[model samples]
Target: MKHFGGNDRDDDVRLKLVETLYNQPTSLMMAVLTGAMGGITAAIATQNPVITAVGVALALTGIVRFVLYYRMHRNALDHDARKLERIFEAGAYAFAGLCGLLAALTIYLHPPGAIQVLTVSLSLVYGVGISARNAARPLIATGQLLLVCLPIAIAGLLAQDIVYAILSALLVLVFAAVVSVTLNLFRILRDQITAAEVSARMADNMRRLARTDVVTGLLNRAGLNHDLVELLMALPEERMLAMFWLDLDKFKEVNDTLGHPVGDRVLAEVAARLRAQAPDKAAVARFGGDEFIVVAEVGDRFESERLARAIAEDISRSIRIDQRRIDIATSMGVALLPNDGHDIDTLMQSADLALYHAKVGGRNQVCFFDTAMTRDLVRRKEIEVELRSAIQRDELSIFFQPIVDLETGRIRSFEALVRWFHPEKGELRPDEFIPVAEETGAIITLGNWITAQAAKACAQWPEDVTLAVNLSPMQLRAPGAALGILTALRDAGLAPHRLELEVTESLFLDDSADTVRFIDELSAEGVRFALDDFGTGYSSLHYVNKYPFKKIKVDRSFVSGPNAGRKSDAIIRAVAGMGSTLDMDIVAEGLETIEQVQAVKAAGCTLGQGYYFSRAVPDYLAAMLLAQERERDEKARRA
Candidate 1:
C-alpha cells in the first residue's frame, strides 16, 4: 500500500518498508559484487559453504529488485493501458515489502556480518518502487542510484576496507547521476509537446468565430463575400445570377412585442430554416439586423425570380420558438445579374430598390427589379432628402379632427393629425412621408413638435374641452417625450386632465414593457392615454386592460359600412361593453353616415369622431365650430 495526500493506513505500510531499506544501496551492491569477490577470494583462500551462500543471496536480491523496478517504470509510461498501471503499482509495493522483509530476516540471522548492506539496499529499492508508482520520476531515479551505492558503502564499513568502499561509492555515484539527468531532459520535452497542442486548439477556435455570425450562427458577410466571389469566378460568363435580399415583413414588431431575447431565438430558428431549405447553389448571409442576402445562380432571369418566390414562401411558413408558434413572413426582392450588373454593389442596389417596392406594394410579397422600379427608388430618395429639409424648415401643420360626444352631440376633444406642407408637392398626408421620416429618424423631432403644438392649442379651447394628440410608435421610445408634453401643458396653463395623448396598438409592438413604463410615468404626471385604432391588432383588449388607457378608439373598419362585417360589428360592441364595465371611454372613428353614427351610439359608444361631424378643418374653422357649440349649449340650458 502507498499513501497519497494524507491517508494513515496506507502510509504506515509504506513507511515501514522504507524504514527497513533506508540508505541500504551501498551495502546491497557490495554484498552482491564483493560477496562474489569474497567467494572467489575464498576459492583462492580456504573454501567456505556459508560465504558462497551469502554471496549468491545478496547478488540474487539486488538483481530481482532491479528487474522489478524496470518493468514497473515501463508500465507507467503506457497511459492507454490503465490496467498495467494498477498491476505495476500492486507488484511494486509487494516486491518492496518482500525485499524489506528478506533484508530484515537476513540482518537478524547474520548480525556479526555486514548485514546492514542488505537492509540499506532493500530500503533504497523500496523507495524507488514507491516513487515510480506515484509518478515521481526524478525521485525514483535518485532512489535507484542511492540503492546501488548503499550496499558498497555498508560492506566497506563492516569490513573496515577503505579501498573497496571508495571504488564502490564512485561506481554508484556515476550510475545515479546519469539516470537523474536523463529523467530531467524527458520532462522538458513533454512540456513543449503539451504547449504546442494548446496553441493549435486556440487557433482553430479563432478561425471558427471569424466565419460565423454571433447572433444567428449563419455565415457572416465576410464569409459570404468570399464564397460568392469564388462562385462568380467559377461560373460561365453567360450564366444568369441574382441576389435576393430578404427582409422580415414586421421583424421590428416581433422584437418589440415579445422581448429581444425571444427575437434572437426567432432569428436563430430562421437561420436554421434558411439553411434547411435554401437552394443548393445559393449562399446565404445575415447581412445585418433582420435582413438576409442570398446569392443564387440560375439558368435565366425568370428562374431566379421563381427561386426567390419559393424562398419567400418557405420563410412565410410557421416556426416555433420557446413553445410559441410564430408566423414568419418575408418580403424578398430579386436583382438579376448580367441584366442588373456583374458587380455586387450594383446587384445589391437593385435588390434593395426592389425590396422597398415590395414593402410599398404591401408586405409578404416578392418583387423583381426592373427599369421601372428605378423611378420609384429615385423618387423615394428625393422624398427622403426633402423630408430632412422639411423638418428643419418646419414645413408641417396640424389638422385637428373633432371627437364628438354622442349624448351631447358636441365636440368634447379633437385629435391632432400631422400634415407635411412640402414646398413643391403642397400639402402631403402622413402616408406619403411617414415611412420615410421614420426611416430617417426624423419622426422623433416631428413628434415632439406635434406634442408641443397640440398642448399649446389646448389652453385656447373652452375650460370643459380637452385636446387630444396622436403619438407615433417612434415617439414613445424618445427619451423625455412624455415629459416634453407635460412641460408644454404646464407652460400653456392647461389642465393635465384636459390633455390626452393618443397612441395606436402599434406603439405596444415589440416594446410593450417600455411603452407600459412610459405610460405609467406620464400617467403619474396626470396625462391620459387613448389607444388609437383598437381591435385591428393582436390582443388589443388584453393590452388595454394591462395598460392605463383612458380611451379605446374602435377601428373605423368596423364602422366602414352598415353591417359590412359581422365580426367587426361584434368586436365594436364587445369593446364598448368592456370599456363601460372597466370605467374606460370608448370612441368610434370613421362615422361617415348617420346610420353608422346611430349604430355605434346604439352599441354604447359614447364618443364618435369622423366625417359625420366634419373632416379635419383649418384652425380658424375649428374655432368657429367650438364657438357655435358653446352658444347652442348656453341657449339650451336657458330654455
Candidate 2:
C-alpha cells in the first residue's frame, strides 16, 4: 500500500540490456582471420590511405569477438537463452559477411604475386566459413559468399590482379549487406522498444485500479492510508494536518426510499462536489458508503472550523436524484493532528467522536474534537449498543403527542411517538435512540411496533377521533409495509380513515415511484397522508398537486416564534396557502406561544401541535387529554 520510491529491479533489467548490446561475440572466427589477410593485401596494392585504413579497421574490430566470448560462460545458462543466442548468431553472420567483402576488395586492387594469391585464398576461406557458420540458411550465406569470391577468383586466375578484383567485389558486397542488415536491425529494435512501452503501460493501469475506488474513483482505503502517512511525515513541523470525517445525514433514507442504484449515484455526486469544494491543500476520500474523510492543512482551529462549515453547508444545499431534487446534509467531525492526537488511531477516534457529537447536536452541523465530546460519544455508543436488545425485551413503547384542532381548540388526533425505557438510563427520548435504531436496521421492527400500538390505541379512541402514527423512511421502504399497516388496522378494529400516518418528505425519496404509487393506492383505500416538516424540505408544489395527501404540516423550524425570520414566515404562508388552494389540511407544528399560534391561524392553518398542547405523553394520558378537551368544549358552549 505504500508509494514506491524507486524500482531497482525493473531498472536493472534495462541496464543489463544496454550492456548486452555493447559486448556480444560472433561464431565466424574464420572470417576474422580472413579480414587480417585482406588488410595486408590492401597494404601492398592500394597504398591509398583510405583503402588501407578500411582494411586495417576490419582486422582490428575482430578483437570485439574475443572480449564477448570470454564473458559468455559467466552469463545465466537458462535466462533469455534464445535471445542471447540470437544476438551472438547475428553478430557472427555479420562479421563473416564483412570479412568476405574485404577479401574481395583487396584482390580487386591488383596487388603483387604473393599478395594476390594470399588475398584470393583468404576471400575463398571467408566465403566458405560464412557458409558453414550460417548452416541454418546456407543458400543466403553461400550466395553472398560467391558474390564476394567469384569475381576475385576469376580476376586472380585470368590476370593475376588480386588486389583490384578483391577490392571491387568486397567493397560492393560489404556496403550492400551492411545497409540491408542495418535497416532490419533498426526495425527489430523499434519493435522491441514498442513492446516494452506496452508492458509498462499495462503495469501502470493495474496499479491504478488496485489503489482506487471504482465508485468514486478516489483513493481506496489502502491508498488513503499510504497517502496520509506520507503526508504526515513530509508536512512542516510547525503546521499540522486537519481531518474531517463526514457522514451523510440520513443517507440510508435515500437508499431505502430510492434503492441502492440511486443511492450509489447520489454518493458519486457527493464525492464530485466534495472534490470541487475541497481546498487546494486538502485531500478527500470516500471512506465507504456515504462516509467521506477530508484531510486539509489549516493555520489554526478556527481555520479548520471555517473549512468544515463551508464544506457542510455546500453539501447540504441540494442534490437532484432521479429527476427529483433532494435536500442533502452532512454531519462532520474535525480532528487536528498533533493537537487532538498524533497517532492515526487516536486521531480517527477523536474525529469519529466529533462526528457522533455533530449527529447528536442535530445533524447537518460540524463538531470539533474536545474532551466533552469523547465522553458523550462513549455514552451514546453505550446507548446505541443497549438499543439492540430493547425491542427483543419489549422495552420499546409508543408515546402519544396531541394534535389539536385549531378552530375548536380541541384535541382531534393523538400522534404516536417512540420512547425507550432503558434498564439503566430510565427513560430515553426518540432523539436519543431513534438514530441508533435506524442505523442498526432496528427501525423495521420498531416501526411495526409503533404502527400496531397506535392502531390499538385508536381502537380505544372515540369513533370520531383518529390515531396518527409516524413512519420512518426505512420502514416505508420495507416490502409489504402497506400490507402490514392494513393487517394492524384490521386486527385493532380501527377504521382505515381513522388511522393517519405522519411521514416526513424523506418517505418520497424511497421506491419513490412505487412509494408514491403505493401512497396513491392506500389513499384510495381510505389511508390519509400527512406531509410532516413541510418547509424544511424541497416541498415541490408539484408533489402536493400530484399526490393524494390530506395534510401539510409546517415544520417547527418555520413556526417556532412570533418574530420568526422573514424566510420562515414566507415559507409557512406559501405552504398554508398552497395547501388551502389544493383543498388539503394545513397543520402548524411547534406553536408554543399564543402569538405563534395566532400567526399560524392567520395563515389559514387549521391544526397545531407543540408543547403548548402537550409534550408527547403515554397513550392513556393522551386519551384523557382528548376527553378533557371534549368536556371543556361542552362547558364553553353552555357559557
Query: How does each model score on lDDT?
Result: 0.69, 0.72
| Every model: Cα RMSD to truth | 18.3, 16.8
The alpha-carbon lDDT assigned to residue 200 of candidate 1 equals 63
State each candidate's clash count: 17, 24
Off by over 4 Å in 2: 1-199, 321-323, 343-346, 371-639
Q: What TM-score would candidate 2 get against the native?
A: 0.43
Model 1 TM-score, 2 decimals: 0.45
TM-score of each predicted structure versus truth: 0.45, 0.43
Per-residue accuracy of model 2 over 1-639 as CA lDDT, tens digit each: 111111213433333333343242344454565566677567657685655765676576655754564566356353364455445545554555555555545555645656656655665666554543442222334454655555555544455556555655674676456435543443454446546766887888987787788888877777778778877877788887899999998898889888888888888888888898777856778888888998877778888878887888788878887678988899899999889998777888788888877887888888888886646567776776687777788787788888888888777788888888877779887787787778656788778888888899879988888888877887777788888888988998988999888887766654367687668767877989887888666666666766777888887878885557777777777877887788887999898988888888887888999998789988888778878877987898999
**Looking at candidate 2, what is the lDDT of residue 561?**
51
